[model samples]
Structure formats: structure tokens, C-alpha cells
Target: MVPMRTIAHCDLLPDLIQQLLESNSDTHLIVCATRPEFLLHLTAAIRSQRADPDTAASHDLLTKTIGLLARSSKIRLAFCPTLESLRAYLAVLGANSNESTEEIRSRDRQLLSILDMVAMHVTTSEFSAQGLSRTLASAVEAAYSAGMDLRLYECTNALDPSSAVWGRKLWDMSVPSLNGSVRMRGDESTWGGRGVTVKRVAERWFEFDHSH
Candidate 1:
């Protein structure tokens, strides 16, 4: 039997790309969140290592990899300028793709409509902040309606103790009802300042608290 294939988020490590090339001769590879410079470097490295006398086989591999990404349902690749944009795109894509192709396409159109509305509001420079927030809220609502999990990460002003306190408070308030858990990083003084410490909060009052 053929081994089950896997798809990984390639944004984290370039070495992952090399590993995929070595291990998965027939497996489809989809790369996302790659900068143009990185892509060029990868292409150059692959070309330099080509063993084929005519280099046609190596070129074919490159073409095939790109083609797989373009038409893959199991793999959705996207590049966004900001992490927020990436998160937003993932939320929409995840929600839409849980259904039939036609349904997914319809959801895509609706998402685009929401984006257009937000863009128009921004252009007018009238209540731009409110408009942007509304746009994000609309997108999140659509995601939730489609049964996708959407989460917004909290920003930390590391220099301010008050900011950290508020951040922890907000997390504490929000995490209790979630199916997943939340954590806080402990001070280095607790463990003799040797390594990182993480404190896991319980999702349910009945559950035990743990630390690592």
C-alpha cells in the first residue's frame, strides 16, 4: 500500500522543503507564505543539484510541483503580507472548503463582497477604524456559521507591566469556555532562570491545573 501523504505549513522552515523533495518522490508538495527571494533561492539550489544530463527531468519536477499547488483541494497555499491577513484568509478558506465545490465558490464570492464593502468604507476615510472592525467581524461571523474555529491573538506591549496584566486578564476571561486550553509564560525566577516555563490553565473548573 502507498503511504499516506502529509501536508505541512512551509512558512516555518526551508529545510522542510528539502526533506519533502528527498522523501516524497511521488507526493504532491504545496508551498505557502514563501517570499520571492526564498523561492528564487530554492529554485536555484534545485537547478544546481540537477543530475539529469539534459536537466529536463529536474525542470519537469519543478513544473509538476507548481501545477499540483495550483489545482490541489487537499492543499491550499496562500501568501499574505501580514499574519492577520493570513489568518483571515485561512478562516474563510477553512469555512468554505468544508462543503461542496459549488458551495465553496459561493462562500468565496460572499467573502469578496465583504472585503469590497470594507475597502469602500476605508477609501471614504469615514469611520475607517469602525469599518475595518466591522469587516473582520463579518468575516469571523461567516466563518463561525460555516463551523470554522476563528481566534484573534492578543497583542502585548512587553515594556508595560499594565499591558501584560490586562493581557493575562483577557486571556483568563476568554479561555474558560473554549474547548481548547490557554497558557501563560512563567517568570524565569521561578525555575532559577534556566529554561522556559509554561503554565496551563484549565478549560473547566473540574479539570486539574498543570505546568511545564
Candidate 2:
């Protein structure tokens, strides 16, 4: 038989992404195989669903999970195929403007929880080229449009702009986010000493741009 990776690499990834976008929960997990990076996303999604962050293990798990979901391949989970449906769905996901900070935090976490499901898919995508595209970038765009200081996230993974899985739209959304007012602090706990992430994003982009 042909090697599974060769076969899977050829056919499985695209179909898996399609099913994930188009199918219901029962049908989503039925792929013949998937990319390892893709599997990491699925694992993160499932883990995020029941993750209890009171413990360090659970906290790291959910934070990593969110970071993975924040990557390029999975960012489309934030959107829908149709405009009317997307707007209605986003209205449901969004916190009310006048809501308290606690309410917004609670609601955003819940929204991220739901996003975990939509995001579990393969590394590669053509969603940006499609006319029906919806992406995490759209939300970032909306945040900027609303004058919100969209913040960069925490991650142990070196952000890879070169990776194929970090889909185009997500790459776009995440890159511009480096410019936000997310200053790093002296304490390692908060943003890590003067926006190291801003520097990382800039340097990564610089390297990627030059390397190309």
C-alpha cells in the first residue's frame, strides 16, 4: 500500500478541513488521518472544553490550548460561511458594550471555549482566497475598528510565520496585533519585560520577509 503519510498528505488534510467546517460534531472526528499539527489543534480543543484552570497543569493546558487555537489554521473557527449568519453568530458571541469587566471576561472565555470547537482543523487552508471567507482576522479588524487595543497572547511555541498551518488570514490578523499597547513588564508574569512579543513578531516578520 502507499505510505499513509503520502496518501494522507495528498487527500486527507483538505477533506478533513472541509468536514470540520461543514460537518456536525458526530461527523467531525471521522477523518482517515490528519497532520500532526492538526491533531494538536484537535487535542487542544477537546482539552479546552473541560479544562479547569485552578491547577497549574490545567492552567498551562488551557493557555497552550488557547495559544494553539489562536494560530493560523484554527482562526477561522471565529467566523462562519455566510455573512448574515456570521453577524448573528458574532452578536451572540460578543459581550455587550456596557457590560462590566467581569462580565466581559466571563463571556470572552465562554466565547473562546466555543471557538475551540470551530478551530480544530488541518494546517493548510484556502479560506482566505474564497469569497465566503470568515477568519479570526475579521474579529481583530473589528477590535481595531472599535478602538480596542487588541493584545498579543502568551505561548511557549516560537511563533512561526513560515509555517503553512498558520493560515494566511490568521497570519494577517496576528501580525498587525504586534503594534498594540501590550507593553511587557519587569515581572516575568506580565508580558515579559517590555513587549518581547512585539519584538518577536517584528523580528519573525523581518526574518520571514527577508528569507523569502
Off by over 4 Å in 2: 1-87, 91-95, 99-126, 129-137, 144-148, 151-163, 166-212
Query: What clash count goes with each model?
Result: 0, 2
| lDDT leader | 1
* Tens-digit lDDT track of model 1 for 121-211: 2122221223334434554555444433222222222223253222222233212212122233574112221222111221111121121
Q: Which predicted model would earn the best TM-score? A: 1
> Whole-model lDDT for model 2 versus the true structure?
0.29
- List the candidates' TM-scores in order: 0.28, 0.23
The global C-alpha lDDT for each of the candidates, from Candidate 1 onward, is 0.32, 0.29
lDDT of 2 by residue, 4-42 (tens): 000011112222333233322211021112345445644
The lowest-lDDT stretch of 10 consecutive residues in candidate 1 is 197-206
| Worst 10 contiguous positions by lDDT, candidate 2 | 1-10
